[model samples]
Target: MHILRELWTKEIEEPDVKSSYEYVLNLRERLDDTLKIAREKLEKARGRQKHYYDRMAKRRKISVGEKVLVLLPTDSNKLLMHWKGPFEIVTTVGINGYRINMGGKEKTFHANLLKGYIARDQDTSQATTDERPPTSSCAMPAASVTVVEDLEGEHFNDSDCEALPELGGWGSEETVNDLKYGDELTLDQRRQLEERAIMYSSIFSDRPGTVST
Candidate 1:
């Protein structure tokens, strides 16, 4: 009983212990308030950032049936790339979104990732003939195939071969000459064959000379 009384008296001699515990509790509350304030400030900064970003964003207006190019995210080693699509707008999904036809398949995209496509004006006038690429002289006009019915050696079984006709143009002329007595081709047939041969030779030679009919 005497020792317990002496401990109680020693605690009474130290008056600051209770006040020190209360001070630690108060400091903890202040720290919590500081953290809350910091979090609020961070949120405000994020809001401001979003506001600036939206302010700088461009508004795009597009309509159905319009042609547009789409953007795609890709990892590539190439220095330059062509944008993904020249897709057609099928419908509007919302104010800034649309449904597009991607190579026959339907897909959706946002306006921010799409660009309007402008087609070059095509001249419908006769002047366009000048712009027209020169007709490739290398390509021979369609010709009629004169399939000989007589027994022959090394004959063309398929008339699908593109060749100039005896007329110096494109067409096929099939004729069967009565050569039952001999393997002799008629004079008219010979003339026709010669004309076709000359026509094809002229085409291959790339000669600028014209053939007389």
Candidate 2:
């Protein structure tokens, strides 16, 4: 507008369509000025935003195999149970990015969305023991047990075992007198007694001179 003031006062000639370059140049200059101001304002806004973000931002160094917790939004309106992991890092994906094992599925996450896991002393000890490779001398070749299936008769049928008594306790006076033992018994003793009861159930139920209760 300042540069065009002299031209505006002296323009007494008939408007020639072929001589409109000067008018177009003036409009172009104004448009460029407006664009420059807009760009400056945008840059300043960006700088302020960057400053705010940088105040709380931190450089998190995470490695593969390290455990981390991921930040996740929850269904509840209350801010509870928001973070979900302790998932192991499987691979490093680009800058500030990692691939983690989430219950056997792999998920990619940014560093800002994760936090490092501080394992307890007991947990560290347990993990060390679990992760330690066995020595050559300690690693014995696994023995393959051959299953001998007797197809000749229907022996060792799981369906038959289901029909057998669970044998919780001595159900009758006859059973109590026959065993002649207290209710309190060790696991092995109880199992043996149960097996005996089952065998007796088969024998006495089928034969004579035997009581069934």
Candidate 3:
């Protein structure tokens, strides 16, 4: 089943609308069949799943400012996001619906809607060993942030770089000095370089706003 899902999802890339719908339908049917089998097996098996799920109490109320995913209505597909923005609940619009404020706009939806609305944020601490592995991509570094970072950067001394790494043993000291001195910038070249630096830095002496001035 996983191999089939991987092939349908990762291997196939994005199938056309028709294919995706058909594929999702097939997946749900398969999942339903698998669950049915599991349930029947549980009934006959010596061991049983815990009654924790049965003991859980249903929450009767939801309120304002809490973040929640809108459970969508399968009967209607008029809404853009069947599951969308973590909308803040404006107020309880009764058992069938809720008045929600999403992205600065107030909208309402039925409480009996589609999927992803949790009564409260699920406890991350309740995560089991079989839950997803730590995703490396975009995961933040596990380090305390340094608040007083130097903006100008750690000082890099020019004197250390001034001593060339090698003396270029192929040439005498005088010969190398002559070669470097011969390549030194001319006055015009130096002035042009200084102008370029100023231009790149977007710095110039104060002048009247008018170009002619």
Candidate 4:
């Protein structure tokens, strides 16, 4: 306004006015034109920017059936395994501003709380990943034995033979009594059982340090 007034006054003071008056009017017209163009271009740029952001936000959004955890100021809670649940994506709700979810019947949490959400497929072993001791009992190996005759085949007095029973008492009372003075040998008889146990453990070992699902 000041510049416009000064130019006007200068034009008025001029005795010959046509040229100066036209100059000032032209200058003001140029200012209006520039302003109009600038405003139009600015509005167009703003609309384009809004559209781009809208598309970007949509691309980043998670929908129902997707498992996602809500972001928080600190991931410390997540690190500690303090966070809960593998809540499934139940629904979506938002208008591009601060949207939220109505969640599922089980967990009716807000969309902002989506950080608590985790992909069901990936997050699966997350909750139950830790392990505990197995609950089954293992079979025991059995033993075997063989007998060896005494060096002396003839009957002997009490001083020569002690009343020692046969190997495992595996014989009848009369049989054991008859062989009381005989020698016996014993051996372990669980080859098949031992091999089965070893094979069973190795097959289920699942490549060391890996927890079975």
Candidate 5:
């Protein structure tokens, strides 16, 4: 009577019933060997994965009191995010964690979410100087000037210089006549014509009147 299919169906000479204990002991030893092989293979696989990860992973060490930008979500949308802060690192929490001081509040964050911030040095040589001629008290006060209103109800005050929309070179019929170029003109000649059009742009002003001496 075969109680177990795998042990009973084996094509071998019948084992001596007297030595059944020895056969069971041998099977136990074989099972131990199989388990050992499986453990070794698992360990080797883990080691290989660890080696590849270590090669690509950068080891960043941020010290206490150092300024770092923290990765955070934007106010408009949580999914849309950007690096927001140059918060100071207050202390290290644990192995790969850091406590950052955001304003007066302290928050713990992972090392991966933080980046060091480098400040740029100011250039003293490029400092600007005021070169405008001093205005005399006899000059007319700017507030006394009259304000003009366009047809669209938009007001143009004496103080505010509103920027008009660029009409390119085709703004007026006169500009179009001056910028006329033949189709056969070379690229350099066309570029020169464009430069001339830009230089004469002041004449294509949309202002109400011309300046009088």
Candidate 6:
């Protein structure tokens, strides 16, 4: 039975031995044509998939001495991963790989497993400066004065400093006014608070190398 052709219809005719041979040869040619078409479609599909993947993938050109975070597995669990290090790129290993200074040791990493590290302090300072009200300039720069006074204190300890008190409500006119503290506190109390803050100002300081042991 010629299953491929006969399955569609009941009407059938048995071929002569010579005719059967020709039919088998014809089927083989048809199969080769079908296989070629199948292979072409597969190649086109692979090309389309590659094009979409390239479009979605992130491309970064990391330079030497630039800081980047690396994706790595945790010590406790190999399956669990996290971004670690703001490690400096010592050199480029290859087209998409970087050699990082993981402390004294160097390790090569693929670019896909690395991302640029941006220091938040600079951005935070800029954002705060921009968002500050114009009237704040007119107000007594008590914090700036205090910071300077704190720097002079030789006994100031970062470990002694406490966490900053949270403002009850943020971004309100009252919150801004309350931050001045001058109008709210008595003269003696304000002086004491300033002395306390100055004694432990190392924690509050944004300056590098300010924290001493």
TM-score of each: 0.43, 0.42, 0.24, 0.29, 0.45, 0.46
Residue-level lDDT of model 6, residues 1-213, one tens digit each, is 465455346334555654665687689989999999999999999999999999988678999999999999999999999999899999998699899999899999999999999877987899999976433112232223233244343443444344323234223223221234568899999888777776766555433454358
Model 4 Cα RMSD, 1 decimal: 22.6
Query: Top TM-score: which candidate number?
Result: 6
Q: lDDT tens digits, residues 1-213, model 4?
A: 654666656745654565666677898899999999999999999999999889866334556666555444445554443434455565554532223332534434455455534344655576466443233343323233544365554543454323433344323323211222213422333444455555665443323355589
User: In model 3, what is the error at residue 50, expressed in angstroms?
Assistant: 26
* Alpha-carbon runs more than 4 Å astray in model 3: 1-60, 72-82, 114-213
Q: C-alpha displacement of 65 in model 4, angstroms? A: 16
Q: Ranking under lDDT, best-scoring first?
A: 6, 5, 2, 1, 3, 4
- Candidate 6 has what TM-score? 0.46
RMSD (Å) per prediction:
21.3, 20.8, 26.1, 22.6, 14.9, 19.0
- Give the runs in model 6 whose Cα sits over 4 Å from its true position: 1-17, 54-58, 122-213
Ranking by TM-score: 6, 5, 1, 2, 4, 3
TM-score of 5: 0.45
As a whole number from 0 to 100, the lDDT of residue 55 in candidate 3 is 59
Our model 2 lands, by Cα RMSD against the true structure, at: 20.8
Better-scoring candidate (lDDT), 1 or 6: 6
For candidate 2, what is the lDDT?
A: 0.72
The true-versus-predicted C-alpha distance at residue 81 of model 3, in Å, is 7.2
Per-residue error at 48 for model 1, in Å? 3.6
Model 5 lDDT on a 0 to 1 scale: 0.73
Clashing pairs in 1: 142-170, 143-171, 144-171, 144-172, 145-172
How many steric clashes between backbone atoms does each model show? 5, 0, 2, 9, 0, 0
Q: How far is candidate 5 from the true structure (C-alpha RMSD, Å)?
A: 14.9
Comparing candidate 3 with candidate 6, which one achieves the higher TM-score? Answer: 6
Which digits, one per residue and each the tens of the lDDT, describe model 5 over residues 142-211? 4234434555744444444433332333233444345568899999999988887787776655444577
Candidate 6: pairs in clash = none
